[model samples]
Target: MSSTTRRRFQHPAALIGAAVLAASITACGSSDTTSATSPATSAPAPASASAAAGVLTVRDPWVKAADKGMTAAFATIVNDGDTDVTITGVSTDVSRAEIHEMAMADGKMTMRQKQGGVVVAARSQVALEPGGDHLMLMDLTRPVRAGDQLDVTLTFADGRTQTFTTVAKPFTGAQESYAPGHGASPAS
Candidate 1:
């Protein structure tokens, strides 16, 4: 073969090999960077208020703030045991706290005490939220504000009680209305 022809083939082959090596290096570098930074870049899960019992767990317990009148507390009760559990009552440091239900009565929305307590089925969960079944806090000794914390206690059917610390957050979302002032008559 002519020397010139051999030179042409060698040059092309070397160039091709170099190109392939460069591409492979770039890909490896990018993959390493992604893997190294994944944990730092990814966000952590939002913290939730929780209390644990032998057979029960409560999550995301929170209270709505009221100037000086009435507000509500919500939580999720998870029953992990094989037997059902009934949440008989709720008590808070405020003046009064009770388990209340919002329902349509006589073609009007009425809020009243829930009879027989709230039952969490075995291996299931019950969520107490606004406009549904929740704990009503009335006659507050003082005003509640955002970022404040309160201690609430729950009474179970089996004579077991669990106390949870809940954070107070100002919520302006609409809820089931009471007859007159919706029980939030904003301090006289």
Candidate 2:
């Protein structure tokens, strides 16, 4: 081919290649940063409260690894606003999620749904830990193994939602009994 013809083809090819590279970078570029010791924080959501409400964030979010049955997620939900924040519901594509509490019922500790959702007071935080309060993932759509990452969405009472990514790790604690009709037993 002549030099002019070659230049025309090469210019378009270079442009296409650059565009693909840029697209790849954009797809993989996520704001979430996590480490073995550090917690993964969610992006700041708009302050539903006054300007002093600041922002809401989830810290050190993680999930339990399980092949099937049920597992739970642990995190510290921080609310920096002047008004209280209530997480009414939790959701994930991998399973049916619910905010659960382990409380004494009939002389025994049993796991059941939280009655009034989870309330994080103004300028305070709520810790969702094992054997206390947690986000329960039931009937997993697929097996969750160690080192896997999952996206969890928290719906606030004000109709605002914040989605965060959490990594799965092996956890053997919180062996509380499940209430009847909840679902299959928790993974041992």
Give lDDT per model, in order.
0.67, 0.71
Stretches of candidate 1 off by over 4 Å are 1-55, 175-180, 183-188
The total number of steric clashes, by the backbone 3 Å criterion, in model 1 comes to: 0
C-alpha RMSD of each candidate structure in angstroms: 20.1, 10.7
**69-151, model 2: which lDDT tens digit per residue?**
77788877877778999999999999988998877777766677887789999999898987789999988889888778888
- lDDT tens digits, residue span 1-188, model 1: 99999998998899778656654543243221223212111222122323222345666666776777677887677787788999888888875777888777777766778888899999898988877888888778898776677888888888988776666765545644422366432321
Give lDDT: candidate 1, residue 50.
Answer: 30
Candidate number of the best TM-score: 1
User: What TM-score would candidate 2 get against the native?
Assistant: 0.66
